[model samples]
Target: MATFATSDQLLVIIDPAARQTDGESVRIAKDVLSAGAAAKLCLPEGPEEFARALDRRGSRRPVVIGDGRALVRAVTLLHRQRELAGCALSVVPVGDTALAESLGVPGGAVAAARAVLDGAERRLDLLVDDSDGVVLGALGIPPAPGRAVAARPVPIASGRPWYRSLVRTLASRPARLPAVPSPCAARLRVEVDGRTVVDLDQPVVTVSVTPGTDGVASVEVRPLSVGAEATPLLASGRSVTVTGADFRYRADAAVSGPVRRRTWRVAEGAWGLVLPAGR
Candidate 1:
């Protein structure tokens, strides 16, 4: 159960990197969105500045102005801003719009801003890790002979022809490991609601969970050695816990946790966000 409030208050946070690279586009988004609602632009200088901007967000609807990373930052901040539950979140998706697209946000700045004006909030699932950090979307882990794609900030708009022309591109090749002595494979002990599901000394490329009525269920798991194929992990239960040493994982597009262990709990319909019509 979540509450909803109708208002035009909003706070816009732009990633400084994105601002520096494409100031004009970001400016257009800001101006367009601001025209419709009371909005302020807060460009984060770095992670600290990012966190501080969120801390100062108050109770306004938050509009993120970067790529997937920007949206993840907004989600994490909103999760922390538990008081602002049910607030609208508008994203002027700038960088890799794939993740945001999957979430139903239009890629174009004007269209995204239009969504803010016309869209209604829908409930979306969020992951809460053991260390109390939050991830909005997918998480990736690298496998042996294949490094975790999360290790390097995969350039946001790598493959998109339009975006590639617009922003710097990341590696063209999929994540692969070093030719030298293969790095130690990641070993994770995963459990759902206290029951062991996977425990192995093998290489895992990625793990994801989506929220459901009963709990959080495993959405997908990919192994680096398996090429591009991904196996779907059954979704069931309210809690998931992962323990490992030197584990590198990506929650959504934001990277965190080289920590030994992490736990995630279903926040129970924590976030209500905009989705495409059918979703």
Candidate 2:
């Protein structure tokens, strides 16, 4: 267990979705946090209010009470404000906890709350895109011809201040994607740190990128095959770029796409999270 300073103040911002889905869990988390330290609670009904609540937080560590999407929203908000590096964030997972679990956060509300009170600050890497979008977990580009190249009319991240549109998009259920014909290999140009891993002539089965140690991203590109085993190209670098005919990619839970090209770079230790000691 890690020791916390008595003067450490906490700002508990409970998501409306969390309250609606799991009021009991939210209440338990609140009670645990309140008993553990100096805490101020804010219940934001929407994205705008969430932004405002964060802006009003004064010297208090921000603790989000929701699922993975909520945690992403909070991190994106802080990243947009250029405060992520300086802020230590905490989360009490209430709904879907997959993302939180991947980040080593406790699943139970009480344990998560206790972590917020006593956990140590851990700096983690982030994947930043050219469009100013952030990915906390992994990004995947699957081999689905038309589906990969076709762009969705609506963008998850829109031109809203403090990424309110992105927050709203994530808060709501994603629309069902239209059924595509079938899966086929896509010819994409993949590069890692300016080193060409595959050319457009090579059909790629899938591409995956995730944060790696030492401020680099681990990239893998699997080539298409005909009932035979094909080798996957693996590389680690600070940046990875993919170019092809319009394509869509999955970042965490949200999908963005139909772009000719996209690049992601590792923002080394750009954000801090509260986790158990020795995590």
State TM-scores per candidate: 0.70, 0.82
| Candidate with the greatest TM-score versus the true structure | 2
Residue pairs in collision within model 1: 122-273, 130-263, 138-252, 141-205, 142-148, 145-177, 146-177, 215-237, 217-235, 217-236
lDDT of every model, 2 decimals: 0.68, 0.87
Write one digit per residue (lDDT tens) for candidate 2, span 1-279. 234563589899999999999999999999999888899999999999999999889889899999888898999899999988888889999988888888899999988988888788888899999988898988999623332466646556657676976677666977777675434578899999999999999998899998854699999888988787688888999999999999889887677888999999999989888897778
Looking at model 2, report the run of 10 residues with the lowest lDDT sum.
143-152
Off by over 4 Å in 2: 1-3, 143-184
Cα deviation of 235, candidate 1, in Å: 4.7
Q: Give the TM-score (vs. native) of candidate 1.
A: 0.70
